[model samples]
Target: MAFDSLSAFLAMGGHGVYVWAAWGVTGLLLVGVVIHARAERRALLRDLRRRARRAQYHGASGAAAPPISHQEGRARES
Candidate 1:
């Protein structure tokens, strides 16, 4: 082993603090990214499901839902 002991390996020749801090920050950021991505995916799926239900309801009534682009344009104008 390059390090004589476990303590020495962890200490990293007096640079342990900086090295460990960097590793901790990297781990935290990776976890945050995964969590954010999952939340975004869930939100997108929920929005899609809601839109499908709305379309089905409108179709059953023989009324067509407005095109997404037109709705978006009207919303923007408002």
Candidate 2:
């Protein structure tokens, strides 16, 4: 099927209202999802950077981080 004119194409055989509304809602939802994901990723990265900074500060101060438990570390040679 071919649309011979722009107005007829937009009218979409008189079902344009439903079709256009569905398209608009889908576009809005897609945009919202993208924005939400970007925000979440930024927040997670910021938290990671903050922790890295804290670790560096502690290292520079010559403060030792807590040692891993022996059981969680290397096993002793039998």
Candidate 3:
């Protein structure tokens, strides 16, 4: 409504370049954040799965050592 026509709206009284550039940069950054988050999530899940498999393999073979509690560790250190 404020703009008379499509071309005039796009021109934005000669300030369109700056306004559109800002919008483009903001959009790109938002997209990059989304992509990075997804990649991190996938890597975390893959690492967890790998750890689980390793634990399972060790446990099945009776080679996995039992986890020590903090108290036990301190006693051993002393």
Worst 10 residues of 2 by lDDT: 69-78
What is the Å distance of residue 32 in model 3 from its true position? 1.4
Candidate 2 Cα deviation (angstroms), residue 70? 29
Q: Estimated TM-score per prediction? A: 0.59, 0.58, 0.61
Greater-TM-score candidate between 1 and 2: 1
lDDT of 2 by residue, 1-78 (tens): 578799998999999999899999999999999999999789668755665687887776423434334562254221
1-78: candidate 1 lDDT, tens digit per residue:
889999998999999999999999999999999999999789668756776797787676424543335443356322
RMSD of 3: 8.6
Top-TM-score structure, candidate number: 3
lDDT of 3 by residue, 1-78 (tens): 999999998998999999899998999999999999999789668755665687787776434534333563355423
Q: Return the candidate ranking by lDDT, descending.
A: 1, 3, 2
Q: What is the C-alpha RMSD of each candidate to the true structure, in Å?
A: 5.2, 10.5, 8.6
Q: Kindly give the stretch of ten consecutive residues in candidate 1 with the minimal lDDT sum.
A: 61-70
lDDT of each candidate versus the true structure:
0.76, 0.73, 0.75
Clashing residue pairs, candidate 2? Answer: none
